[model samples]
Target: MKNEIDKKLTDKNIKPTAMRQLVLKVLTEQKTATSLPELELEFEKADKVTLYRTLKTFEENKLIHKIEDGTGSVKYALCQDTCECHPQDLHVHFLCDKCKKTYCLNDIPVPTINLPIDFSLESVNMVVKGVCFNCKK
Candidate 1:
């Protein structure tokens, strides 16, 4: 597990520090997108600033992506191995109203948009809000 975590970090050109390795481990275990506050709960003794910085570094290196699911709190999820955070690489996010958990719909790619000649695409964040399968059950 440690070797895998280290490899993931190294692949993203991020040095595998203790904090980063631990944070990445937590992220890997998540079934849904995670927020800073949620991650804070995982590492009670660790400094919040350090965790935030580690997340930022991972995001900067494209190891993870951030989601703004209209809940005001930004959530982070591990990116697909081939993900480069491009427009076409973006996918729909599902925000469960009941469980309040956000999930990455990786199989559902965002539709292509036709923009004016002078315009360019930057990023797309499409969030679908509804009750998740677990919540429905």
Candidate 2:
């Protein structure tokens, strides 16, 4: 597992530090997107600044993507191996109202929009809110 985490960081051109490795492991093991507060609670001994910086580095290197699930708090998820963190590479995200968990629906591609010639697209975030399977059960 450590080897895989190291490789993932290296593949994204990021140096594999201990904190980074731990963060990646936690994110990869989680079924839903994670928030900074959640991670802090998981790592009680870890410094908030260090964790925040690690997350920022991951985002900057395209190792993870941020999702705004309309709940005010931002969440982070590991990016797919093929994802370049570009607008076209982004997919849809789902937020479960019951469980309050956010999931990445990578299989469902985001539809392209026909905008005016003057319109320029920087990024796109599509979040569908509903009850997740686990919540329904």
Model 1 residue 14 CA deviation (Å) reads 0.5
**lDDT tens digits, residues 29-131, model 2?**
9999999999999999999999999999999999999999999999999999999977789899999999899999999878897789999988889999999
Error of 1 at 55 (Å): 0.5
Q: Candidate 2 versus the native: TM-score?
A: 0.97
What does the lDDT come to for candidate 1? 0.96
Best by TM-score: 1
- Tens-place lDDT digits, model 1, residues 1-137: 99999999999999999999999999999999999999999999999999999999999999999999988999999999999999989999999999899999999999998999999999989999999999899
Q: Residue pairs in steric clash, candidate 1?
A: none
Q: What TM value does model 1 have?
A: 0.98
Candidate 2 lDDT trough over 10 residues, lowest sum: 107-116
For each candidate in turn, the TM-score is 0.98, 0.97
Off by over 4 Å in 2: none
